[model samples]
Target: MGATPYSLVYGMDAVLPVELRIPSQRVMMEAGLPEFEWAQARYQELHMIDEKRLKVLYHVQRYQRLVEKAFKKKVRIRDVKKGDLVVKFDRAPVYDHRGKFRPNSLGPFIVNEVLFGKAVRLLDQNGETSTEPINLDQLKKYYA
Candidate 1:
């Protein structure tokens, strides 16, 4: 028979007995084969390695879908619109030298305009618009 694909490409078995025990090892040992013969038989099984890889891929994709569904369920769709009152997250609050008890957000700013993508332009209490657009994730709706 031809060499297994793994042995052809890597010049070694895809799995070594020391790393993972072969299920047939016990049966081969009971058959009174020498240690080297048992090892050779295990190498012959490596041709099925592609099937094992496919099964792992199927499990990984299923796990990823489950995680994605959980994440999407927890995510809130922001309904931010123009003229909405919102607070911006204070990204550099630690650098302000404020105490640890200080609030981690600033401004009940007004949404002056909704920009392209998940961004918005804001107007402070003074009604002056900021020059740059802010990401929607950085702003939370202000209640009061």
Candidate 2:
């Protein structure tokens, strides 16, 4: 009988949003289809111009870090002998990829003995010699 509240009523005749709305002038202007009388087509197209530029910049920065690490030779196998305190890589086995050979050092493993040219036998935390010899690069110097 009287004007129906929108929350309590709905039907094909419900033109509520268009009829019951009072939007700010700025909102209509930004949508560019304001009033359906005038169209500013360029208004919404400019939003991603800077967004794409930012994505490219971020990728470039990551590439630079990789390049620096490669050139500086930060990761390389070294020759470590017994009684030398060294830190192990400590990365988990889950991270090891096919060629990467993830050797996570536990406790900078004490170099109990150098078994062969490349393999250094280590005294693991359990006070037992590990069956596998660790590469020098997998061993980092241990510091307090």
Candidate 3:
């Protein structure tokens, strides 16, 4: 997580603009070395680039798994079946205190078909069917 994008991709630390203006320790260290020796040292560093890339890959995969685990904790699994009655959720923001006028959800609609994973087709109370599929989150089981 502490890795910079340049380091992740290049397998080495970036030479900042500040370092160029005011010489850095690495530049100072390489200053006195012979040209052939410096070339040998650079080759060694390049040889280890693959190892650094592998380490970064491992870190990224671990982070992704942690995120997936945290996300799964808040998930609620909803299951519905054909012929089961369910109330469709109302998306409206309005709220009414009066019992007679307050209707937050629609129908006791019968489940007509269960579609691909979590989507369901519904038949309204008046025998009219909904053309579009509704997500499981928008439905709650109706009792009695």
Best by lDDT: 1
> Tens-digit lDDT track for model 2 on 1-144?
555566356532334363224333445555565565332333333345467778999999999998998988865557676876667676564644554654455585577987666667777656787787777766777766
Per residue, candidate 3 scores C-alpha lDDT tens digits across 31-91 of: 7866667667666666677788899999999999999999999987787889999999887
Query: Distance from true position, residue 76, model 1, in Å?
Result: 1.3
Provide backbone clash counts, one per model: 0, 4, 0
Q: Please give, for residues 11-112, the per-residue lDDT of candidate 1 as tens digits.
A: 865655654455476666656889898788777667567778889999999999999999999999998989899999988736555578778889999999
TM-scores for all predictions: 0.66, 0.36, 0.65
Q: Against the true structure, whose TM-score is highest?
A: 1
Error of 1 at 93 (Å): 3.8
Whole-model Cα lDDT per candidate? 0.85, 0.63, 0.85
Q: Give the TM-score of candidate 1.
A: 0.66
Off by over 4 Å in 2: 1-77, 93-105
Off by over 4 Å in 1: 1-47, 95-98
* lDDT of model 2 at position 131: 83
Task: List the candidate 3 regions with Cα displacement exceeding 4 Å.
Answer: 1-30, 93-103
